[model samples]
Target: MRKVSRDRGYHHGDLRASLITASFELLAEVGLRRFSVAAVARRLGVSSAAPYRHFPGRDHLLSAVSAAAAHDLRSAIVAAADRAGADPSSRLASVAEAYFRYVVRTGAGFHVIYAAELYAVPDEARREQTRALMATLLELASAVGVPSHRQAVALVEAIVAVAHGYTTLFAEGFFAQGALTVDATAARAVAAAEALIRAAGDR
Candidate 1:
């Protein structure tokens, strides 16, 4: 006799992906402190134990989500640099603009990727991935004669700071004071990046 299964929608081979998707939705709704594997399973209409088959626990699941977010961020950065041609200054500006645009586009996912303390997982891999992506901007700064590794890194950090700061301020409605549009804000971010590169050269 054939036995009936009781997993409830867990038969789909893509349940792992589904669980990840649900986790993000839950994250958007309740945030990381309250997010749980059982909630993801419930969202998938599966047994609470179903997620354990794919992820050992919530921390592991969050790590996967953070990794995926980093991959997406890397793609956006690469595309922006490619579009800016071979000009180092142009590439820096483009990449910075793209970073801010991506933050505006993806919102909370950006925080999930970069905010390490929230997830309670090792973020060395994520940091390395971020470093790799930032390497292009650093190389461009170097090409344009930043003169030393420290200065190049400093320029990159300054640019990233502007982008990150703008993202946070915009999210918090700080831009509402000026009624600045996203395009306007991104333009300012690009200008800030370009100014930092020029300032490095001046020093």
Candidate 2:
């Protein structure tokens, strides 16, 4: 599935969509810092100037990619939480697990969706998508009980931080140095997230 998404060649049809798909591969290959519209065009066998017809600049292209990534992330979180059944704690833990798993499985996904450079101003659509995703975590965190409303926000933050932190470590080869697997890391994220949620109730 991952291979299919990354390696899809642009035989015909919408060239704009093809550019975005090619950008995904370029991003995963070289990351955001070095990503280029020219490179994506080359990947699609289009002229270096081809992507400019759809996207005015690299930032515009990246915004489109980030928006798409935000939608994908939201879907993954909702599906994982729903599958966890009626347990509030399980649902929240599953959210963290799903997020961690997604970042590891899809290269440049987390970074692309939450890029610091782009969010300085933020696009309305992207912001709304992210807000919806965070709202789910906030709802689940509230269900577990918080000493105060502010603490509920903190609970959600802690879970997201832990999941992203673990994923970043895994990406940096911190887990590969040992006998660790993606599933194992995701479980660890779940445990850490659960522990934090439980502790939040104690406070």
lDDT winner: 2
Query: Which residue segments of model 1 deviate by more than 4 Å?
Result: 1-11, 22-48, 108-111, 117-131
Instruction: Give the number of the best model, judged by TM-score.
Output: 2
Task: Pick out the ten consecutive residues of candidate 2 with the lowest summed lDDT.
Answer: 1-10
The residue-level lDDT of candidate 2 at 54 comes to: 87
Q: Can you give the lDDT of residue 173 in candidate 1?
A: 83
lDDT of 1 by residue, 1-203 (tens): 01112343545587777776676666655666688888778776878887899888777787776666666667787788889898878887776788788766544445566566535666576567656766666776677777789988888778878888887787678999899999999888898888877877777
List candidate 2 stretches off by more than 4 Å.
1-8, 108-110, 120-122
lDDT of each: 0.72, 0.78
User: Residue pairs in steric clash, candidate 2?
Assistant: none
TM-score of each model, in listed order: 0.75, 0.86
lDDT of 1 at 139: 77
lDDT of 2: 0.78
Task: Give the Å shift of residue 46 in candidate 1.
Answer: 4.6
